[model samples]
Target: MKKSFLILVVLLISGMMSAQNGGNDMKKFESQLPQEGRGNVRVAYQGKAIDQMIYEFMEEQGIPGMTLAIVQAPYIPRIVGYGVTDIEKGNLAAAKTLWPIGPISQGFTAVAIMQLYEKGKLDLNDPIGKYLKEIPEPWKSISILQLMQHSSGIADYREQKAFDVSANYQPEQLVQMVATLPLAFDAGTDVKQSATNFLLLTSIIEKVAKMPYHDFVKKHQIDYLGLKQTYFGEDIPNVKQEDVTTTANVHQTFKKDKDYINPSETTTGYVEKEGKLVVAPTISPTSLKGFADIWASAENVSHWDIGLAGSVLIEKPENRDIIYKPTKLANGKTVPAMAGWQFYNHKGLMDIKGNVSGHSAFLSRFTDASELVCVTLLANKEGVDLTNLGRKIAAAFDSSKMGTGANDDLLYTYESLFSVDETMSKIEKVLKTMGIPVFAKFDHGKNAEEVGLKLRPNQVIVFGSPKVGTALMQENPSISIELPLKISVWEDKNGSVWASFPQMNLMAAEYDMESNPVIGKMQELLEKIVIKAASQY
Candidate 1:
């Protein structure tokens, strides 16, 4: 009995110590999270400080692994990874970790079509029937450009109730499933994304190049750019060299080096099951075909993007514009999106993003900024949209040109990770922490109840620094009407909480005080505070 008691006591002490260590580590991590000022976090870039936004995002979203690549003008300054690619094995994610970049493959397909057009082998205006004989008669009349831009009105096979996403389907099988179905609309009347459009494009690519779709993209895009870490679905690229410098897998300060880094294995896909993560069923490469088959490291994906920015890939500026420009319907109205990319209100900002079973991918390009900035994010979690996070990360590099603060939109709203009441409490706490006084709290829901009206969980917090507000009001006294800044937190009908604030830059334009320095500072502060309150640490 004495021996057993001693062993039990030791085990209990060890368990308590382990729990204490874990808690301490978590505290340290939270301390380094992104806020208004800097923290003690270093990343593996050219003396660049770690933003910590990505870390906080992964923690909040329960993401197992992710790879991020940032492109600044002509140089890719940073490519890094966080968390484990294989949760079961606890394998660390790295820059070279391969991920299935869903829908981003459409960009590749579009490039191939453009490359052929540049070669005079195909024309964007040519009807599909000119190259593809197997397509339906209606589809045959659709212009190649229409198909590329999702204006073909083709029935999407993936959307059919009978379709099994896990089944290994050939390109022809997918096309045939929707072949007998009627078009959703006239050939070029409207815009609707369909995987079948890209499938036919793949067939056309095969016919024109006399090679498989993957091989053509490999030869033209991958091989041309010397992207060794890029490959077709499930086909991880091989490493030839033996010796390579490797960054520490966990978050730690990394030394700069010129040596080639060893590539990590592709991340395992995951899906949530009963509030826990489980390995997702492997999706067949054949099923993804032309629309979503490509797998690549975040760094290589951005590298390929750099190639697209110049004449190296497309070779002609006008040809590149053909794909980048929005699609126009027969009614003469141009769609706001093209080739899986959507044009944001911000000038020259465009992005392509989607989920592939158990993986989520995002790529954003700030083309018209003074410096070109591209961000690619690949995470091993399904259904999580990274578009906002990508834009936020870009803003960290150049705040003046990216994110909500500089967005051309009249207002930018953020999705809160908590309920309306909780989100409002967080906002109030942040105000207290920042020493910014809260003037008043308006509980709209409560007010509605008192007035015998119904309202959702809606509330607003009015707060700001008087020093900054005074400085701004000095420039334009009329701005005071909009001053004493307010942030609204409310729950939409869908039960998702959101926080919204006006773009200070737009307000400056309204009041004709565009040159006021306080405007910029106020914009930056509001952005930081909202993000901190809206997101989970």
Candidate 2:
């Protein structure tokens, strides 16, 4: 009877302790909540209830694993993980679960370049030939700044499928392969996102730093920022199989019924022979160094973001600003997007996103001088639209921003009442009526079909008046990149045809050009053209 009474007392104590722990957890969550109107933390995101919304989103999106980190200025970041890392093993995702960050690695590479710049090791205007000889003609003249801005005009190697999944090449070989390709345009005349640009930048970093690319990143970015969970390359020391999140299985043969089998599950074979499953070939991360292949947890990425905001890594605040600042062309017009980052003047935010074979990641940093909020998301699945997803989460804290809520500079979109072809035809007709010259009309869908590929209805009509365009270009010749203006008519997923173009006024602001009479006239003319094309017959 006495022993039974002792056991009862112990059970009562345990129950009381569990309740206290729960209260403490609640208190911690409450402390993290934005105070009333200060952060404008939306009603739905209040308290600890945001978890339920995230779970529902994961379920709706079919995301097997996801890690998210939200940071508000000087406060500690709130990092959380949702869903399972491995479907077969049933391993739960966690904040520290590592996931490949894909091309987001370029941001880190950019930082390393800036660090070299800060130390006076290299000049932004220095030609590529200065760092390494035998770079060939046009590329030799390309400046370091142009490479960072993707204005070097080097053709992208990925476009040619130059490297296979299993192929590995040394840095020099990668540069040589790119050299064999012709320039897209003259250096600094236009901007295009090219992995080749980063490859060149990586080579420059290696030469300037006199160290291996991965080692430099490890010491300067990963270790310096105290990102314990971050690492370069595919392997992380001392990490177990279950500790890392696997990329979503993108192969068609890997699917079981309608659902995808976990790539991490060794028991399930992905091979197909006469409709039977067999052992699948192991897929490795791309052997390309510096431009891609960095892996980190959501929590570590947030730490890097925080370090970027603070003086931890780049000591000078101005140096950090240079990393995201738009590239000013020779004629004074600037590209809104920078090296690895994109600037959104409407909302005062800078963000970067990357997608590789099986992973998608997004990092957004709000640049409001008074307030600091950063959102980092890492997911195992490709094609998840991490930009929109990141923006949706960012809106919970501040919803006043506009323009897609992401860093994409597509400032205008107007749905058309007609089909995509009809809309393009109408736009062309309007241009002809206005006496504007149609420089080119590209049928992208038709081109894809010619290549035995399927694409939704899409076309671009390039038209501009020489009188107006010349006036703008005379003001800033760099504005020519935006000239020969093009309007894209495409069909969205829901079968709605639409016309989209960048806002002229926003472009004016981005280039820092004074609003002239011609600017206003061009804006008015474009709006009328779009309206006429999108109007009901």
lDDT of each: 0.78, 0.69
List, residue by residue over 289-390, the lDDT tens digit for candidate 1. 888888889999999999978898998888887787666677786665788876644567677888887899999898984648899999999877786678
> How many clashes show up in model 2?
0
Which portions of model 2 show Cα errors greater than 4 Å? 1-49, 242-286, 400-537
TM-scores of all predicted structures: 0.66, 0.62
Residue 172 error, candidate 2, Å: 2.7
Worst 10 residues of 2 by lDDT: 263-272
For model 1, give the RMSD to the true fold: 17.5
Query: Tens digit of lDDT per residue, candidate 2, span 1-537?
Result: 999999999999999999999999867877677654245445233232456657765664556778889877655457887776555545556776777776778888888888899899999899998987867777888899888888888977666656653466665666666777788888887777888788888889999999977788889888876776787655544443432234443344334433223322111112224533333332244454656667788878887777777677777888777776766776565665777676643335677776655556789887676447778887766545565456556655644432232223334465454678878888988888878889998999999999999999989988887877888888888888898888888876546566777777678876777556676556657767886776431
Which ten residues in a row are the worst by lDDT in model 1? Answer: 37-46
Give candidate 1's TM-score.
0.66
Looking at model 2, residue 63 earns an lDDT score of: 69
